[model samples]
Target: MNSAVTSRTLARTDSVRPFKAGAYGFVLLGIGHLALSAAAATATQTSERRAVDTVMRESTFALLGLERTVLDVFNGMSIAMAFFSITCGLLILAAVRHAPALVQRRTAFGWCALAVSLAVLVVSVLLLPPPPIVVLTVTSCAFGLSLRRATTVSAHAAEAA
Candidate 1:
């Protein structure tokens, strides 16, 4: 290749890799959140089943006054929330991976992911414990900051050249 073309190509590649890495980091973060949510849902479902069984066997409908309807609703809500969290994770991964042109915009995406994760953490505190979600949130934020820094450095280098 000609010198000018070669240099330009190299510059583009240099700018691209960090963004790709950042995108993959988001994917990993999503996967981590999905796994954690699934684990929590399973544990919660199992516990609910046990409670139902205990109530049925012990005939404590009056003492504890736990109704099947209430248990079912709670279980359904938990499962629904888990499903929504998984869907959001998948969507974030897909969005970043499919749109390479948006590499420069990855910082914004990362921030969004981090914000959502924080919101999830707050909700988890009110409802359930989610240490894994917190971990993933921090991880996503780091990747985002890395992407922004790399992009800024590349832009400066390109300007100097």
Candidate 2:
């Protein structure tokens, strides 16, 4: 690309600052979650964890007419959540790169992300340990900052117009 185009691209990328933080937070946390979940699932279990694993593996419940062990259900949920978090991050990155103007204008995408992040943060606080809780806290905060910045820019543009 020409220098002019390259410069414009770099400038555009630079403009949406806080969105980057939130997007990377979601992406990185999802990766960490996936890695930790897989490691914990596979790592040599301690006595207590082994006992719980046995119960989880042995215990069965019917859902949608299918029987599933607690272990199976829990693992499935963990994988699903990892994918969802990664997708949310990718979507935000796409929005930031491909539709910066729309992002600044304040869209449903931003609102949904903020809401989902906060909801996850709350759940993490209640159920998970410090690491996930801290990640969610930062993710939610970055999302909130990005959205608030977008709202301010939109308001200023409106006033100027």
What TM-score goes with each of the models? 0.47, 0.81
Candidate number with greatest TM-score:
2
Candidate lDDT scores, in order, read 0.54, 0.79
Error of 2 at 25 (Å): 1.0
Model 1, 69-151: lDDT tens per residue? 55455555655665665566556556656764444433566556556656655665576546545554564565555455445
Tens digit per residue, CA lDDT, model 2, 22-138: 788889888998999989878988999989989999999997999999999998988998888888788889878898865565677777877988998899889898987888788
Q: Worst 10-residue stretch by lDDT in candidate 1?
A: 6-15
Which pairs, if any, clash in model 2? none
> lDDT (0-100) at residue 96 of candidate 2?
82
Return model 2's CA RMSD, one decimal. Answer: 5.7
Off by over 4 Å in 2: 1-15, 152-161
